[model samples]
Every structure is written in C-alpha cells, then in structure tokens.
Target: MMVDEHENHTIDTVISLLDILIIIQIEDDPIIGIVLVALLKTVTKDRLIRILLILLVITLGEVSEIKS
Candidate 1:
C-alpha cells in the first residue's frame, strides 16, 4: 500500500488538528488530565521514551509536573 503526497498531507493535517484539540481539552477540563496519564502508560514499555517524559500533576494550583 502506497500513500501518495496528498493522502499523506491529509493524514498529517488531521493528526495535527487532533493534537491541538487534545491539548485544548486537557487544559480546559480538570478530568482530562487523566488522558495524559493513560497515554504515558501506553508508552511505558519503551525505556527511552519513558525517561524523556514529563508527567503532569493536577493540584490546588493545577500543577502539571508528571513523571514517567
């Protein structure tokens, strides 16, 4: 299966838009912070990736300092 230039561009654009939406959602909703934790869990098997992560913590001041 080959993805042509137009198809690749469209896929990238959609991913970028989704990324923006996710960031907005996480910032706007307190509960949405769990989404990041869930994402971190998904990538934990890879040590290199895990070490590079900065975790978020929802607190009185809504601090976001998470660790892997």
Candidate 2:
C-alpha cells in the first residue's frame, strides 16, 4: 500500500524521534532501531499524534511492538 505525503511525513517524523529516544535508552543496532520505529508507524496509519503516543508505548514495551 501507498501512503500519502502527509502520512509519509508523519512516519518520518515519528521514526526520527523514536531514533533519538532509542539512542538514549538502548545501545542496539541503529538499523534494528529504525525497523522497530517503522513497525510502530505501520500500525498507526502514520497519524502524527498517534505516532507520538506509539513512541511512548513502544519505548516502554517489553517486546517493542505497537498496540492499539
């Protein structure tokens, strides 16, 4: 599926922010961090606010998977 520009931007923004957080909290591979962030946005439809909240949840998740 294709995402619109707005959605793409939202995903990009969320992933960037998540990348920063992961850098601070974890010392894992950056590629894994990015993939995790992308997975979070995938389930959130690229909504900016939802992405923000998902960041929090994913950061706190034991498994790094997004939930509704």
**Backbone Cα, N, C clashes tallied per candidate:** 4, 0
CA error at residue 12 for candidate 1, angstroms: 0.1
TM-score of each: 0.38, 0.39
Model 1 C-alpha lDDT per residue in residues 1-68, reported as the tens digit of each score: 35677776775565445434444546667456457645755766653353344222223223443431
Question: For residues 1-68, what per-residue lDDT tens digits would candidate 2 score against the true structure?
Answer: 35687778777776677656764544556676666666665766636675576567556754654452
For all candidates in order, the CA lDDT equals: 0.48, 0.63
lDDT score of model 1? 0.48
Model 2 CA lDDT for position 39: 68
Error of 1 at 7 (Å): 0.1
- Superposition TM-score, candidate 2 onto the true structure: 0.39
Residue 40, candidate 1: Cα error in Å is 8.3
